[model samples]
Target chain A: MNRFAGPDGNIETEIQKSLLNIDGGIMNILSTVIRKTILTVSFVSLLPVITLTVSAQELNALVWCDHADDKLLKPFEEMHNVKVNIKTYEGTGAALSIIEQSAPGDWDVLVVDAPDAPTVAGLGLLEPYDASTLPMSDLFPQLTEAPFNYLDGKRYTIPEKFGYYGVAYNKDKVDPEDMKTAEVMWNPKYKGRVAVYDYYFPTMQLVAISMGISPDNITADDLEEIRKRLLEMKPNIKMVGDIVSVQNALVNGDVDIILNAAEFVVSGLMPTLPSLDWNIFEEGGLMWIQGLSIFKDSKNKDLALEFVKYVVSPEGQSRLATSECYWAMPANSTTQLSDAEREILRWDEQPGYLARSVPSTISRPEIDAKMLDIWTEFLQK
Target chain B: MAKESKSLKPLHIDYTRWAFHPALWFTICFFIFPLAVMLAISFWQRVYGRLSATWDVANYVKFFGSDYLIDSLTNSIEVTVLTTVISILLAYPLAYILAFKVPKRIQGILLLVAVMPFWTAYVVRSYSWLLVISENGILNVFLKGIGLIDQPLEMAYGQGATVLGFVHFFTMLITLTIYANLVQIKSSYWKAAADLGAGPVRIFFRVTLPLSVPGIVVGAFISFVIAIGDYITPQILGGGTDILIPQAIMLQISRAANFPMASVMAVTLMAVVVLVYAISAKHMKMERV
Candidate 1:
């Protein structure tokens, strides 16, 4: 007999009679289903907590995608005997918003744009640490004592990973010589074959450099000229996108050049596609630096500091520089990288690049707002 | 007589009246509450990355004043409308065949095949489309191999590609809705029309098409609502050549943490959807489908 058959062995009639009995039939089935759904949803939502319960301690870090690599995290996780829960975000605005939405002590560690460290510290989101404890001399000299990392003579954050905002392009498609200068952004020869990286800070600064204006000296009046120059390049531009999209454009041969991108965008792919290359402009390059800091309200300050130290160590720095997501230069000059890896990162040229480039500006609110407005206009154009 | 008739009715309360309470509460909690919050936030100000409760309309004013900001809405409408029209045109015929010509046993399999695209991740689906239509993509390679042109056609990173992606997804949605409505339609109506001296074409024109209007409207309306608000499809497939309203809203939140501006854009998008709903409400028979 079928399992669902009734006592009399008449399946159709029994099922009909049962359904007719509303008290024991449809309503019961519906309520059971609803109960099961709620139970399932509740269980699924509690999964992270369940995992955390098995671990001795948990360190929650808000970081960039590079820090989420298992290779970079697993060693530290094993050493500290703690579970690391990482939530990755892009852009300072988004990171700040995440911190604002979170309760105190919810996040123990933070990785942010090095330039925004002071702004964050001002908001009382960061905890200061003693610089003497760190390998201060081992770090790239330019990154060690920037004004952004300090507030009222106290160090709030330390530089972790650094790279340049330059051009990544197909060497076969565009002249390597032309890539050396900022004016290649609007070079008529490569018109309709350029994809600009969709970050307002670096792209505007790069354009300002092309027009002989430094990023730090960008006033409200400079914006009109910048806007005109940006709009003029729209005809040459095919698309403006994030890292992945811009990378896809170069890989797929959709565009010859990716403006405001560099080794961080294409280094991972260069081994497979030899024609792909990146370089800073003759005028100047904008250096992007990421910093690591502990949250001011962190309950696990000791564990957070341990994680920070581990990230800045030679082994951690090497792992992070060649992380699965993207590759960039480590902030520590003594990081252990393979010869090929160092070559791809242009390690030998760092001193010259550092000398020629200034860290990307962290603009005041009014200037940032105006720059964003012009960027929005640029995208629409 | 009226009093006696009233007394003849059952004295027990009808419990079915409370059946819709869960749905009502769900809407109140999920929809009305969030919308209210968004409306409130739209009037606030964003100061140095934190939301300040100024209760001013500066965000809205800025949105209206900026041409580029307004362009995002226009672009969204253009893409969404094109997607809806093209989807309905493609879906109606497919739904007609599924309802009338296809065998009953195989219809289930065919419908499943049609909606199989929905099983994949939305972002993955968009990227797949990009791969198929990109410069060095299969389409160009195939065309080039056949001597179709000297230069590859620029297909990806444009409004056209965005529409293509939307049509691929939403056509299946519309097909299912229209098919549901078409199957529910009794064949007797067609036979009766035929017996009354109407030809097959005339019968379909007079009976089937008119009766299927509800399905068309409902599906088209849903396509409009979803496509207008979608961010991923356009962001990946459209290649950010032109920004959509959702992209603009994300820019505000992600780049500026300007919740007030983002909320203003959200409210505007919701208003457009509501306006479209109001226009289509008369032709809709949501429960029937």
Candidate 2:
């Protein structure tokens, strides 16, 4: 044992010191490696979640079945990587109620008819859309300066589609030449053989126009006169419903003529029922445009603005026009359409002719929200 | 010493007796409490896009004030009375045949046939009736083919159509109820009356008819209650002219967004049903005695 031991007792103490030093060094190196690895993994894991959280802002889009195209939204979603929840309401009243209830933050983008735009913008629910930020030079002059969008030199909504309400008649029952004017609808020659929209707004407005009342200065007395005229023509109406049902009734010969039907409804029925003919009234018809507006309190303001641009863009508007044969006059002037497409879209180039053909009129007083109770009372009675 | 001895003795009590008992308090909390809340809200005013806590009776006042509301209420009562009478008349014979004439093995099959329409969706059954009653439908075609009439009659939107639809849909349940009560009566009672030289009509009036009063009352009560609240058949088949209580309530809620008015109508309906149930229960008990 003495031989195996070190030469001095201090030898054991020196070896112990050496071992402790090596052990401390190894532990320090291992801790440093572990800290770096953990930091690296945590940093990598957080990138996607942080990006997603930032992109998870609220989105609002107004949708109506068979009206709003769903395909145009895909590119916007891919670019922004955010959820675009579209809320589709059935009727005009339901849509108005949605905007009234959830104003500012309720919807990010709204597709409202041109007549409703003034009322909606007047309520301060829509923000002033800065057309200068987008390619405004490419838009049509009429669309850019449309009275519906321009209020006090500030534009609130941009026109996406334009159409007209006209009379669609069954050629088998009604001669095309005989149904050229609005007065034909009121003529007693078609008693119990014609139909009109059930809503009083369109019916009353058309009646007012035929009665020679200026569309701009329609009053309560004017409305009463229109109502009386309508009641007198009640014997002519076989049935009254929306455009689709009216078209079906026309094709089936259940009704000879339908007043206030959209151009698209008549055109769509033309292929199936070859006898159907659509004619614009010479007294003037409603040249309506549906415009898109951004909600005031939208969380996804930038995304919503991008959506509006996409809708008014040549490609987006053209896509809508081609698919549904929608009477969409593209806002973008740069877009070129084929002759067939132009005919189908019903493009009206001459400003004076277009103006005289489809008269731009204010919405009826019956559509005023304050007078809804009165309207319902009259309807129920 | 007595206290020490009582402590030493073991106490025995059965804690398992309540294992099958229902929780009455739980039922009251969930079911009864919500109904009470609805009744309370019915008496209040709705303001500023929300219900106000103010107790205003204007909703009730409006319901009673309008001739429209009064007319709908009267129509509902009239329809209920007519439906009850028709159901009873149709259900009594079918119930009698099922309980007395039919064989034991075949009775189940016959009862199934009676309740077959109930197995199908009510709307689908109602719609089938619509097709049968439409202008160009089978009934008109047959009637015209047989030279009964030159033109198709307008039968779709009227009170007659609505009452017919209700009776077609509800007769099965009435038959089943009457049959159930009829089967429970012992045949020996009728046998005993017949052996005493009583005729068929006499025995029916004396024994079978009196014994079956319970089923008649229950069937009539159920038919009346259902017919009073029904609005869909009336709305679709009765056209725009028929405005029942439920339709008025629905119009107020959906078209007008007037929840207080709808609630008031609902509360009135509930009161009528409760009064009817109370009267029926009293009459049933009196007859039993």
Candidate 3:
């Protein structure tokens, strides 16, 4: 600068120095922005893996298809920061077979038939639980400390969901008044327009009710009368199906009436097909209560217990009631439901329905075997 | 000298023979071993949910004693026989057309088009048939629009519906098999028969039909075995008006957890298939090609 510039301060040199300073500042800003962008991208990419690694712990349960819905599981997942693994089964027999084939500690929870609670616990598969930890005060009162929840005087399970097995029909296609009686099942007017539920326990219980016998007191001697009635109803039925198939048959106009239908079938379809509806028959209906129990070999018992508590809570009950797989009445009386949902589920009529309904109980092995035999014969006939 | 000659036998070996025995051992370990377990279980008793190994033949006795249960066997055989005969009658002509009438250049495309329905899920295919034939289904809707009938016909969910579902699937299988056999029949054989003063009808019965007996028997035997053992078609399409043996077996396993009884039913089914195989093996050797 001394050799090329004049005393008055060389303007060219000054301008060059200012320009270089500005360029250097710009370069510094660009490097900082690039570094931050890479860091943010990397952190965002690894979040799920980090979450999974930290919450690698999972609670495994054997449940029905209703528990497969994410709306019922997501809030709990977010709260506990844990994964829930579930396997669905059709009946208690299928559930037992699955558990027998699994290794110890492979399952953390079980959702079994309420009547099967004692029998299942007797096998030493479920652990005894303290009753006071749960919000028992919020339950329907009859569900808490009920005979079905105890085994040898120890509390082992709690009712989570319950509904009645009865009939659903297209109100316009079939007379709503005729549906109140079980005798309507075999009426010639509805011939080739009826769908029977394929399940034996409840269907047989419905038949027992029609025979003036209680499902809880069914004996080997009563099976013949039930068999005759079922055979008489066979020709009137167009199909025998599970919950979904029978529901489809009714909604698609293939059948006008469904015997052994429950709220699980008609709840979801009510919005689209306003004609779909259900009611307990005057002859009688069997009430089914599904309960949740902890496994003795659960490695994640603490988390599993938390999950059970969540499942019976008001918010959780609302979610489970409207689960995507199907819907049933929540066991919690204080469950949150809109006015419309309450109307659809017939909330106001539950007291009368509950009083008239019989628990879906079964007989001892010998009598049960006889009942199944008669049921098989009825299917063939 | 005798010791030296015995020592120098050159160790003759066959590598292919070594593999054959291992494959047989593998089959025995996987298939025969499970069958043996099932046989042992059939004698056991299931009281409540517990499995008791006390040996007895009560399950087999029940199968033979109960008329309703035994009737499932008769239903299975009747349904399967009718399905096999109907499929053969339907598939043979279509197979003949494809093999002889269709040009060879377009044969591959035509075969693909023919079997296109089978490319769907097995369960979905049965449901598709149900949708087409149900009371409110496409056919009924189309017919009702044209004033063909006042009431919708009951064409779905019965023994007839089950037969229709089975025939729809098995016809593809039988057609493929018969088409293979038909193509293998040389045109020169038909020419020789024509030159021998044999009319078309005589040539058909004497030459064409007799040569294809193995194909028909093989297809029919396969159809009989599979259709008899299947549970889905009868359960879905038979409308619970009738029970098949597999449905009865499922009732035991699915709800009762009575493996002993289920195994008895399964073994009885195996015996029936074996009897059919024994009868068919006299004339049709499926492996003789």
Candidate 4:
């Protein structure tokens, strides 16, 4: 006998009897309604399990690694009776891919590159959030750039953190004076003793900046020179890597200097490795801004907006700046910091650093593809 | 009698035939369906932010046309071939030792020892290798202290590091497979060879190796497929110096959010794996195991 043979397993008992009672033509309609009702009931029964899986108070965010730190999120999570579920990605590219794969309303918050805010918003990916309650007065003057936090005169993404992409070096091995110029990047003296940041946009822009082209005004004509300059430095570069890899290169003494690193590389390590430091070259550095935005399709719009507001708040800003991923300067000017953290960020030198840096330029698709091609060639060199 | 048999068939269905249903459905749903989707998407194009359903081979053209992109596949094959060959060379001896030299009473424990490192995570194993070989790592510290060199050697980055990481993992896998093949050989075959006046070396070359081709080929083919499709080892240790096909595929998805381009590269990778399987199928009698 079949294992399922039993009174309950026999479909003919109830369903067949019901079908026999209906006329042939009417049977189809009756069966359709019955199926719909049963499906509705089954779906309703699964509601609580689904709710438990992602509770009402839970906020799902796709963001950078810094926001994943429990220390950065704990207070906010506790006070709001909510859980902040974060998926950290290294770049806006990776983050976008993650968001694309997710179901509608699956994500509540998005932390992305400040320059990408306008582009992402135009894609209808961001919710236009009111920033009236936010401590806008306490934001760093430079971080309030319209192109970054505002799109078409409306708020989309709010800058949460900002840092320079420049030279980070071990003072014991590198001459600090020589580090002041971009020329040190390709210097033979540092051959096989340098690691570079692996991102194409900022690295290419930094190269353009060195060659007297403002990042915002880089033209196709400028790329030939830029590519040549990048290739020349290949022999000197021991490795090109992301944040953690470049930091590992420096901390492990595998490289003496990171050609495109900034405070994120040395800020946390400054105390343990006091010799590690960073500086913007005379040619200027690329300013990278990270911002927070609410997803357009977020189910929890109110909660997500509040979370974004809190991230830009003074208390949240401090914790975020010192998050375990890496340390950088928080956008909120009122962030409380100890003497050591302040020293590492060089809090007093903000004006000087901002003066010598240009925020990242919004990339056009054609130009972006061209630059990526060049960068790929440089890596293979 | 035949009409009665037809009635009996309905009451006593061939349940044994239904056993293969699960595997068939699994293949259709997971493997065949996804592969079809990937293949279909490969001909689609993604222009800027827009994904067009209009079929075209621009992606495949660009993939093959770009030297930079083509180099990654070349590099992948080079690395995978070297890793598989090196793995077999190292694993065969260890497998031989375990199968022949180790006492039967303790062979299980010895085999367990061979698998001890596999218990650790694969990514962790690669990370450990990086830590051990970095310029300031123990290898350098010890070498310097022993007066081997005045300056620390660079051993932790580039293609070399990637190969070392792959070889470390694949060797263990190949060893287990080869050892299983070795022990299954009949003892009478070796006895007959010795009686025929064939020396130990001759007997090993003539009798043992010939019997073990299936295991070796199976292991090597597995190693090749896995090492070629892998993204992590090259990403973490290769230092972005050499791009592998998997990395290039991810670059499209991540950097450009270009799904069509990524799909093309993935399909290409699958084609290469299929070609490899076709070539090795003759010596790959996995059913014998």
**What DockQ, between 0 and 1, does each candidate earn?**
0.49, 0.09, 0.42, 0.42
Best by TM-score: 3
**What order do candidates take by DockQ, descending?**
1, 4, 3, 2
**TM-scores for all candidates?**
0.84, 0.66, 0.88, 0.83
Per-residue C-alpha lDDT of model 3 across residues A1-381, encoded as one tens digit per residue: 565555666977665555558957655676788999999989999997888899998889899889998988888999998999899997787898999999999999999988889989999999999877777887876666568789889988988988888988998998899899988877898988999888887888888888788887877788888888888897788888767668767766789998887687898888777788899988776788889999999999899999999999999999888887788889998998988788778877877787787677656787777777887887785
User: Which stretches of candidate 1 lie above 4 Å from their native place?
Assistant: A1-62, A73-87, A92-109, A295-310, B1-22, B47-57, B195-197, B286-289
Model 3 alpha-carbon miss at residue A316, Å: 1.4
- Give the alpha-carbon lDDT of every model: 0.90, 0.68, 0.85, 0.85
Screening candidate 4 with a backbone cut-off below 3 angstroms (N, C-alpha, C), the clashing residue pairs are: none
Chain B alone vs. reference chain B, TM-score for every model: 0.90, 0.86, 0.90, 0.91
* Docking outcome class, model 4: acceptable
* Chain A TM value for model 1: 0.83
Per-residue CA lDDT of model 4 for B1-289, tens digit only, reads 9998887874567777876799988999999999999889889887666788879898889889999888888999999999999999999999999899989999999888878887988778877888888988989999999999898888988889999999988998899889989999889988999999999999999999989988899899989999999988998888878788888887777677678888988988998999999999999774443
Model 1 scores what on Cα lDDT? 0.90
Question: Cα lDDT for residue A21, model 2?
Answer: 79
What candidate 3 keeps of the native contacts, as a fraction, is 0.55
Error of 1 at B60 (Å): 3.3
On residues A1-381, what C-alpha lDDT tens digit does candidate 1 reach at each position?
997788889898788777859777885788799999999999999997886676669899999999889998899988877899999998777898898898999999999998888889999998899877776778887887777888999999899999999999998988899999998988999988999888888898999998999888898899899989989888889888888999998899899999999999999898888899999999998899999999999999989988888898899999999988899999998898888888889898898998899899677787777778788887885
lDDT of 1 at B113: 95
State the TM-score of candidate 3 restricted to chain B: 0.90
